[model samples]
Target: MTDQAPAPAINADRLWSRHMEMARIGPVEETGNCRLALTPEDVEARNLFARWCREAGMELTSDRAANMFARREGRDPARAAVAAGSHLDTQPHGGRFDGVSGVLTALEVIETLKDAGIETDAPLMVVNWTNEEGVRFGPGILGSAWFAGRIDDATLDDIRATDGARFAEEAAASGWRGTATPADLPMEAFFELHIEQGPMLEQAGADIGVVDAVQGLCWLDVAVTGMDAHAGTTPLPARRDALLAAAAMLVGINDMGRASGEDARVSVGRLKTATEGPSTVVGASEFVIDIRHPDQAMIAHLQEECRRVCAEVARRYGCGVEVSQRFAIPPTAFDGGCVAAVEAAAQALQLPYRRMASGALHDAANVAAHAPTSMIFVPCRDGISHNVAEYASREHLAAGANVLLRAMLAKAG
Candidate 1:
């Protein structure tokens, strides 16, 4: 068989410009962005994306969960489509590239295919999954969750934002909630291009990453309640301090994960205590613990230990404790075939790639459950994410997008 033509010459300058312009929407000068899911800024970004898709002659559609799909029909309209893209929602202070690059790259891929006058056997689609950040809604991958039937309408309707705003109300106000169902569309394969969100590629001196699996994640919100007393008047042994118990639990959780080995990580990112008065002992304290591991059994073990530790700490402090699961997603491995395709594409392009597991949870983790899914990762500057300083080089971006383009073309063809 004759070899396929070389990958099209991607317009790096144009791509970077597009990314910069979009980044400015919810921009926070030194920090990254704050376009929380379903917020007004998020709505503005979606509108701009739809407009961009229309300019490229791609038909756009929104599902009931507010997931957006931009489509470019192929030779056979009846077959399942080859799809690519990522989420648009940002964390509280997320960087620009985390989710936006995947989306813009997918759009660029379609533009490249059209400009090259190439036709595939199946339709191509770019997706923008809503609430992937989960900063506002509490659950990440909200769109994909609803699409996969993992989340229902009633549950989604009841989800409230950090501002106590109802999800459905905001979606309707933005005019994004549509009649289409996520599962109604036929998808043959799904691919996502993203930043490594870690230092893997940069540290290894590699240009790209072909993700093999995503680590399992369990997010728990723990609350410790104790009797409030005067800090100066109450003896240390007599006080039932909630904050102290919480601090002990945090340290215990970290120690547990550290002892478990390299794949385990525990983070207590948010902490709140009742009664902001400095002199008053804390009556109640709540914190969010995010635990992740690639091994399912290990994650379970860690979680159990955490629960036991919390109970013990509460007992020691004479406080009541409660743990709630905010989010739980099992470890997910990418399709072997899709992984092979990405590897082959990298080899063809003479690029260096390493097989790595994603430490950060992504929408792809959810999609992989129901579809043959894989992801390509570019390197970030300092393995930083969910911040304004998150950055990736232009060369890395182009390389990742090219891999995405080739992989999608191969699958569609």
Candidate 2:
């Protein structure tokens, strides 16, 4: 970190204005956006972003995954670019700042440097990763996962969107897909600026959150089977109701999570019964359990406990149960250097900040596998996010962006 170098101030008004402008592409409830990945709405957002980047004198490029990169040349052309960004796609009912702020702040950072006539040793890049919300696509953070080599080309191309469109077809249709791969545009470091998405920072009255880690997540699929019977004819003691058994399992799962520890999180977001008729007992039931923890071992332990609870509940209710692991992302500890750079930036700026772990999964988690990566979180009102009411004050956003600017400068040098 340079103590004497002049610090260029980011245009807070411009950043806020850009967010308002992007929200127009897929307007929802005036404050919400529904731009799903690879949709026409998403393409429009990308095009507008590209236009802004070009106007800022940054060259635009995209990879096979359609991860858009806006590059500003540095003093050394050969150095790997120091990157800052987050995904641009929003949840079906997402607020404006979740992923949008990261990409915009990255652009804001470089633009500020340009305004100050200051250049770094390595090129700076602003990235807009694709399919981060995954509302239209199946798995979230699709772009960064591919860039990190977690998903192969064939698998990526074969993926089908919820609207019956193939991933490859949609990427090509967007006109942003290119032959560039991660190998072509390497990164020295990646910083993702995002809303806290949780209430800790705002409740604590902190100006910034220097994120040090991201929690692990796991999904489990459970299927309970039993014979359907006439609701009126079957006696309560003789009936083997799959739905009833599933309900019991749900309660058991919640109880188990509560007993494990405060950090453990278990939730059942999706559940279905084979029989929807009110007069008939459900023959089969299925549900997905979402489990998360900051500790990988705790995640595993919690997973096993859930399985045991389901099996025991099934046996008690005379139903057959099957539990299988769907997918799991282990807890990620960010690079020490990257974490320190963000913390140092906060210290240099003399902002009130705290070192915290992200409770939500982010594209940075996948990027961390390939590059030195960390995140800076701005406090959202009431710690609310992913909702129409989601908001980060201009002052807090500016404070976080300034921290991001300093962090990127430290890494780029």
Per-residue C-alpha lDDT of model 1 across residues 37-108, encoded as one tens digit per residue:
888899999999999899988998887788899999988998888999898888877898989999999998
* lDDT values for all models: 0.87, 0.92
Least lDDT summed over 10 consecutive residues: which range in candidate 2?
1-10
lDDT of 2 by residue, 148-189 (tens): 999999999989998899999999999988999899888999
Clashing pairs for predicted structure model 1, backbone only: 31-388, 32-388
> Where does model 2 exceed 4 Å of error?
226-230, 233-235
Off by over 4 Å in 1: 1-3, 163-165, 220-249, 270-288, 307-327
Tell me how many clashing residue pairs each candidate has: 2, 0
- Cα lDDT, model 1, residue 304: 88
